[model samples]
Target: MRKRNVFYSLFFFLHLLQQASSDVHSISGYFLGSQGLNLPDYMERITVDDVGMYYYDSTMNAEVPCPEWLNTTEGQEHWKDINLISLDNRHRFASSLQSAILQFNLTGSSSNVNVYQGVGRCSLYPDGTLKAVLTHAFNGEDFLSFDIDTKTFIASVPQAVIYKRQREENPVFLEHLTFFYKKTCFERLKILLQHAPAVNMKKVPEVRLFKRTKAGSKVLTCHVTGFYPRDVQVEWVGAGLQSVEEEMVDVLPNGDGTYQTRRSVIRPEENPEEHKYSCVVHHSSVAGNVTKTWEEHSGLAAWIWISLICFFLAIAGTGLLFRRLCKTKDVGI
Candidate 1:
């Protein structure tokens, strides 16, 4: 019985392992190098499964050859040491390489210093699970991870490497490394800010109110366009109060490289005028939340105004005809 129980436990453990492995479909590593205001920056990306390697010149937006060392026998042997057979292992090696490149580009004693950045990413299929680790030479030895599922960021290194590195007792060397890491981190942040999307709040979203004829309900839609940096918040405010539930659509890309999103609210059997409905938008580009109120105009109300105007015109026309006939009769007599 004990042996049977152990067998069952082992099977369950293996099943969990298989499940975890199936969750991740592909892994990739990326590196980018840039000098201040320099054209033809260097970029390289490698994926484990599809598109094994890529090298490009950023300024010209053209493909380029891999580094000379990578083509050598020693380089090939070093690549084999990274064990690129397994996707997960490939990403690990790629991350280490990224870190090495970043350090070399950013920390080296060169007259024309350049910034290097590297990223290791694992992507899961169907479930849209993404795990990404980013390393910058400026940060010293630390790396940051982002989990798409939880929307959280974590900063750290592998436990085994941390233990090994901590055992080294050279104070001066350690201090120098620390200083270089801090400097690298600063430069990386500066480069990121320089490339960040610019904010423009000149064009506000348009809000429209539409009534459903059969359901006797009103729908308020907020249409926002011509926005950058994809991350935008849209909300619905009802009668000066917060809406309990609001439905929002995903942000879509435009032809011009901008982004747009929409939010909508449905109020049933309620007079649109009696209860105010406002669409509020929040974006990094804007100083504050932009709010637009809904103006109600029903088809029945429009037709009623048109009929009243036509009736008044018809009455005036009949009065003029009667006065003209009276003058004619007087002249004939």
Candidate 2:
């Protein structure tokens, strides 16, 4: 099933932003609450520069930090305050999930699940300028957003009218939210960056090429995997090639806490010797761009077959996780 999967989309978006500006730093927190699934009832996670920094669950009922994340902050008030906030957010997740289901009129059927994602994030750039965003989405599409520049709520979809109007009436609440996103979140991001060590620094990408024939049409893919700091750029180009139409799959996760992404393009009519095509990648992890050309050897068909099978299996293992990238907020009455 091809779920919209806001979690994947948001991560992809963050990756794009990071890839765009190598010097930009950001911190994001995600809270998920659900029922009738093969997962925990509620969970919270924090990411610093696309790496997991902290995690919490209702069952464990405690915030666990990555050793690298706390290596410089042990026995300090910073960790203590963040820990308390995580505990308090456990209760908020329950109410927010319930409110979301009711607000969206989710049927809660066995076969259907919709992701209602709300994001509150702040990014600090090399120029000492910061950008803040506060928005919510339903099924990877925008529903509502708070414009930091205007300090007003925007209902992007019809379903979000209720929340937009309700929040608009409460100017005090909006003021406090603006303060959190603009000031507090950035402060948190700077503190975490200051304490974070070189252990979790940028991860260089591993790239490969795979050729597959489906329905008598040839497709070439550049598979890049096992990378950190999720910003990456992939393009198809070679001698005498202007541009080749390619499709980029979502930035999927690896169990070892790294990430992978792929770009595939249908082969155009051309001779391998005369019209060679290569995949070029650009990212901060690498000093410069990395390029890999496709090789079509006589005995390569058998190897490509095996690679195609593994590709499908990998997608099967990675479930279509349709969820949100929301910031920690007081969702209380």
Off by over 4 Å in 1: 1-186, 195-217, 229-231, 240-252, 255-257, 287-289, 298-333
lDDT (Cα, tens digit) per residue for candidate 1, span 141-192: 3444433333333435442243224323455644543442334323322332
RMSD, candidate 2, Å: 12.9
lDDT of 1 at 150: 36
Model 2 lDDT tens row, 8-108: 65454333222234477877766655555455666667666655666777788445644644554432455666677677666655654555567777766
What TM-score goes with each of the models? 0.35, 0.68
| Candidate whose lDDT is highest | 2
Q: Which 10-residue span in candidate 1 carries the lowest summed lDDT? A: 13-22
Error of 1 at 89 (Å): 15
Superposed Cα deviation of residue 328, candidate 2 (Å): 54
- Look at candidate 1 and tell me the lDDT of residue 79: 44
Clashes of 2: 1
TM-score of 2: 0.68
Candidate 2 residue-wise lDDT at 255:
51
